[model samples]
Target chain A: MRGGAIAILAWATVLLVLFIGNWIWDAKPVNAATAAFAAVVTYATGVALWLARREALRPGPPAPRSEPESVPQSSLAAVLIGLSVGTILFGLAWANFLVYFGAGILVLSLGRLVLELRSERATRRRLLGEEEPR
Target chain B: MSVATAPRARLARRGGWPEALTSTDHKQIGLNLGACSLFFFLLGGVFALILRTQLAQSNMQVLSDNSYNEIFTMHGSTMIYLFVTPMAVAMATYLVPLQIGAVRLSAPRLSLAGFWTWLAGGLVMESSWLTADGAGRTGWSSYVPMSNSTNTPGVGQDLWVIGVILVALGLTAMSICVTVTVARRRAPGMALLRMPVFTWTALLSVLMIVAAFPMLILAMTLLFIDRTGAGHIYTGFAGAIDYQDLFWFFGHPVVYVMFFPYLGGAAEAVAVNAHKRWFGYTAFVVSIMMFSALSMAVWSHHMYTTGGVTNQYFAFTSTLLLVPAGIEYFDMIGTLIGGAIVLRASMLFALTFFLQFLVGGLSGVFVASPVLDYHAYGTYIVVAHFHYTLFAGSIFGFFAAAYHWFPKLTGALLREGLGKLQLAVMVIGTNLTFFPMFFLGNDGMPRRVSRYPTHPEWGTLNLLETIGAGIIALGVLIFLINVIVSLRRRIVAGDDPWLGHTLEWATTSPPPPLNFEAPLPPVRSYAPLLDLREQQLDRERRLEGAPA
Candidate 1:
């Protein structure tokens, strides 16, 4: 839910700013359309992530001990990148302009951020002793 | 503490050559890294000589652009993938397990795989020139449009891509293993605070490796697809700026991978040689974390003149890098303040690192500005600056680690007096070789060109640089001799040589399968061994005070 809210806020911001940008610069039809479709896809993905974020890393204090937990950052990055790129190039290629750009940016931003946040929690746990939770 | 509980109680006293080579041991891993890094060091040094020989005369027709490309590429690959990373990785692999007082590296089998993969990767990357693409003239970062499929047509680029991705994977696997081992396998009393500085740096390096490398592999995969017609990676079919985004994302962190461990090694050496605690311990830790974060943000600095995102924002972040860089230097200085300096080979390297890396960092501050980058971007000055910072600064620090720990790894002492002499020559030589490139860059001499129009002024500086290069070569030769003669002699160093400040030195010089019998000390400060030494010294002083 928090992830969805964050994505929505970011998409609305990208859309509003770009709409005003297009209004000011008189952006080409393709670019304007790109901005709109991008926004919608961003929202959709955000909802999906919010629904599924539970299956990802459980938000908690980092590792339960001082020993290093081997967080598989690489495997996660590879899979997310493959999916995001695949979505942009194929699935979203012919989608509305807003869908393509919005989905791409959303996945790039939210997806990476969420993974990073999970890793951040894990790293913090490793770095700071989980002697107690705040 | 009894002999029964010792690590060697489980293994043999000695193993033969074939047995050692096939051994799934951390000790073997260390030896493998050391030997291979040394060999690549010599190979890179030879390439440097070829480059210097060509540059010895400008417009001389001695080497073509393609030739220069191959030479510099091999030189760079050798230094980055082979020399610097391997040496530090070796130091960490050899020392971290020992420092943590573990039975063995967490994944010794994966470690062997990493070594073999690294060896293969280096060979493949170096041999890319012999392929139809004639090696990547796009340089090490291989930034796009030029590195893109449209301009650079060749299997060589594809080979370069494959080689580097493999190497990155190898490093990632090794570092992840190290992280797991350090986390789960420490001796009973060892705490996070008690970990050695080298181990700490290794952990940070491992984290950066796991996080940063997938981007490179992905970027390379895209490029590979573009070449094979699977997908448009760098070309505009997919997007134009994508390559730059991904490359710098990984490339910038790659720079940290090159220096951070050496920086860690230097920190460890300086603290012990000065016989004082690392100053501002908590600040150093914070700076390490900050440096890692900033490393991610500052990737855009490489693209400053390209006009993609916010150049000003990147410049600000780039300039902010100085804070952590400064804090690290200050901490080293703090260790030296009011402390008796031992001035060992390691200390010499650390001092040089402080001075030279500051120059690199400070110079970068000037370059970080968009205005300055417009004038100086892509110039030899940029080359000189990085060499000073990374090669002179970090590479020198790595040499220090090698010399400092060689004794412990091999159960022998290096010729310390010779080590100091070679270290000084290396310092002077490195400065002479790279410092003037700043002026050349300011004067607008660009990088990647084979020849220059000789003016008496430029000629003098070039000659001086050549001389410096020769001096550096001499220093390297001296290092080779030091390793060879000492290891052959095996002069008994015992454990705890130099009154070392980490748990690694607590074990025998050439430790057995396990590092230590007891758990590690509580790591609140930088130097746990110093803590142990002080505690022991205090006990002696107290016992003498008591009725004896």
Candidate 2:
């Protein structure tokens, strides 16, 4: 992750320059506001990365690593959540009953997602415990 | 490199449909996204052929005017949203992790969700054709005032808006994952500058997506609200201009989003086939950064004729794009100079991509001028310009990627003979189909019209374009056949078939679940494998000089 923050910040700076130019020359509220919002989002992303890891702002390659982490093989809940959102939006354009149906599925999927995540965390914990010295 | 094994033990293993549907593997997600995008590409191509048939001759009644409008709208929408944009993301999702030596994507489950959401959006959009009102008849841009309920009223139009919102949301979600992955997931020694050319391009594309796609989602959502009578958001002249500004902000960047990744693909193909590292690697990187940033500032150029934008500012930014574009061409030439050149299918496609995109770029310079744009604004010249860039340029580059990577993806070689044939036919068909439009537009033929008056050369040119469309379809058929034949015959491609420079080639063909089964080669440079090869050559020379 070394230099990650710098890259994002550099891009954000470019956007900021363009945003200022737009603000001065075009001066349309929507145009200026859109440009500003984009710059803010990019800056926020860079700042968040920097805050997460101070080394993200440092220049160089990352240190080599050997770390154990859980990788999910599959997740049905994720697919359901996505479909439910699409359904709710489509229902707004097509039928009212589908909205309720989609909302029901969304709640169920969220619950299922929580359970899946909990199970993944447990698995990770078990692996780490096994790796510890006796 | 260690992964928790307990999760596999805890979760039941499934295969076939269930596994394909629910797998969190980035490779699977990328494949699913790509296969669906290909299907949509074919669907959009059919729509294009239908339009071509209707315009084959003056006053041809192949389709009703309304039908023509719907087909044209769907054609642009399907190609842009469902095919090209997502395909770029699909390539990044699959290849970026492999290129950067990551074990997996940053958020696999979220990427799967994104895939499903995008597919659902595509389905919903296409389902509009089944509605009683036919389909969304407005152009893909669907400018406000005209797209309002009074002028264009129907469930189909509303459905189009909703579909667009969903697609934008899905693409944005997926793009965020890629951005985060690049930020957090590179292997040790794979510094930002040491990342592969394609990975850099993908990073810029996803960054643009994260920055611009929300504006699109917001625009579409407000349009839907306005259509549903919730509010009159776009009510005045200023509102109309506001809508255009917002749309073009996304619209213009999306063009580069579609181009940059394909450009990277073509660049890689060229470097590999030439037996040389990419020339001007650092300059190429800086140029694309400038290229991408200028892409954002040039959005207002699309609105120049509207008279509500600062034309001079936009025109200047739009024209400034040529500097970086010229640098890329120069880099390509530098790479080609005095290198061991191979005339492989992928190399040919890469060369064609550069040659054809030049025409598009030069035409862009002409149209970037406000004075010149006033003449070419709504004509077929604009149509020709974009087709050269998007279809002729990007599609050629896409084929270059496919031919170059099919072996790595499938552990098999595509039929080179068939590939060459397809490339030649496509090149002919593409130029024949789009090149004449420049002349037709110069003669004042407008776009989005189903028929034109019988002029001396208009009928002949339209006839040639229609024939060219068929030829392009034939070329695509040749490609499909090549894929089927190659996959079935099964000429096994081992790891590092092309002696590739990137990390993806350092592993098994098609890769394992974790991408690399063996330890990664030390990533000392962007082209680590190339460095290894050169070191071995130097060692052999030393041994020969020792007189052993």
Candidate 3:
């Protein structure tokens, strides 16, 4: 994790150097703006790493996690959500009815996703409880 | 210490055809994505064959000009958007979790969703063919003014724009997931530097995707709106330049995005077959990061001849690409030096990948100079240059990876004899097909044209290229047959074939639902299994030396 943070920061630094170089040479709004966007993405990723664990910023190994994770085997909602987004976007160009149809499916999928997450959480809690006293 | 909860056992039991379509497991998603990408590759190849047939002789009018335009456009689009880019992601999604010793992806469901989104996007884009005007006839880049509704007005073009947006959006989502998984879900001892070579490459590739794909989505979305009469955003010279700026920002980095993961795969194949750990691992890592960053900065090189860009700046940054590229080549050579090199099919493909990419890289260096680019831009030389890089280079690396990992993915080995034969045919066919284009371009042959005026040299070269295209198709046919034969024969490859170096080899072939079943061995370095083997050898030597 620490190394991942450092790597992101390192890449961000490379981007910053290039960004400055591009800015000084031409300074076109489009060029500068795109370069800036790239830098922001790099920095944000670094920050996300930091937020995930303070250990990501420190020179050490990741702390071993004891809790067993509940890995989902399948998610029909996920599949529906993906297809619906594509359908809605395709509908934007091709036909209007698909847009409404896709939006409806998207809403239903989101609801189903929430339920799946809840069930997953409950399963994790039950497993942790079984292991707690042992 | 970790104890994995087996809560999904029941679901795993039902992993039939239906589960494969909706599975949140990284491996399943990766396989599905990869299989779909291969289908797209075949489709694109057919388009290429047809285009080559049209261009076989001077002034041949087998297909109309507009139909030729649509074929070439879809060919490029399918190869880039649907095949190579997604295939790279597929490899990473399938392998990264195993390489980093994670049981599952950080957001498994998100990864599943991304795969479907990308698939749907591909389908929608292809569906453009059903429209009255046919598929997106504009080139894959679809430069504005020319691509604007005023010039190329059609629902097909509109659908192309929408499809591109969705593809970028979906890949971006998946890339973010992979990025976070690397940042957060690595095993306790699998520090970032200790991660396998492919994982690092995948990391950098996804990082570039996270940074650049958004620009693609934004550009295409604006283009879609502009097409729908919302605004005339890309109008004159400035508008055209702005559109190029936005599109190329994604365009150029995507070449590297298409290259790096396969480079990682080839590097692994080379190192493993050579019986060596990767040479200069730290330097390789640094170079790839620098390489990717530099690629992002050099997009304007494509626009230099347009006279609207800062040629000097672009040329400088573009030429600087040679440095990192040189480091990678040197690393490959260093890995091979004084090592027990085995010419396995995977190794041969890997070696060929490096060698062929050099031709592309050298040609790129020629075009990097603004003076040379003036002559080369919009010519067959440019066409030849990219095909060498994107197809000859990346496809070889892709095959190397497929050969190396097919056993792990399917619990069976691909036949070496057939694999080698395919490689030989492909090498001959690829070179024969694309090499003469360089000469054609130098002789003032233009690209993307359906017909050509009679010229002895141009006509002859076109004929050769058409023949080469047929040979390449035959090679692909053999490969498909090999796959069918190998699967039926089923030469079961057990866990740890080739005495693999990564953590993946520690698990079963076609690994279980949770990836690893037993406790993972100690993670001391990038090649943990290799480290384990060396330690065991040392212990045996010490025991042999002791008094008994």
True contacts kept of each: 0.00, 0.60, 0.74
Model 3 residue B288 distance off true place after TM-score fit, in angstroms: 0.3
Tell me the fnat of candidate 1: 0.00
Off by over 4 Å in 1: A1-134, B1-13, B237-240, B517-526, B546-548
Root-mean-square deviation (CA) per prediction: 11.4, 4.2, 3.9
Highest-DockQ candidate:
3
Candidates 1 and 3, the one with greater TM-score: 3
Query: What TM-score would you report for chain A in candidate 1?
Result: 0.32
- The better candidate by lDDT, 2 or 3, is 3
How do the residues B1-548 of candidate 2 rate in per-residue lDDT, one tens digit apiece? 11111112111134776887788988888888999999999999999999999989999999999999999999999999999999999999989999998989988888888888888899889989999987888989999999999988999998888889888888888888887887777777677788899999999999899999999998998999999999999989988999999999999999999999999999999999999999999899888988988898889888878889999888888999999999999999999998899989999999999999999999999999999999999999999999999999999999999999888787778888999999999999999999999999998999999989988799999989999999999999999999888777767777787889999998887777888778777777788789779878888988889532
- Please rank every candidate by DockQ, starting with the best: 3, 2, 1
Worst 10 residues of 2 chain B by lDDT: B2-11
Q: Please write out the lDDT profile of model 3 over residues B59-115, one tens digit for every residue.
A: 888889999999999999999999999999999999999999888888888888888
Off by over 4 Å in 2: A52-64, B1-14, B546-548
* lDDT score, candidate 3, position A120: 98
- Candidate number of the best lDDT: 3
Which digits, one per residue and each the tens of the lDDT, describe model 2 over residues A17-120? 97788788868889887898788888888887666553432333345554678999899998998899899999999999989999999999999999999999
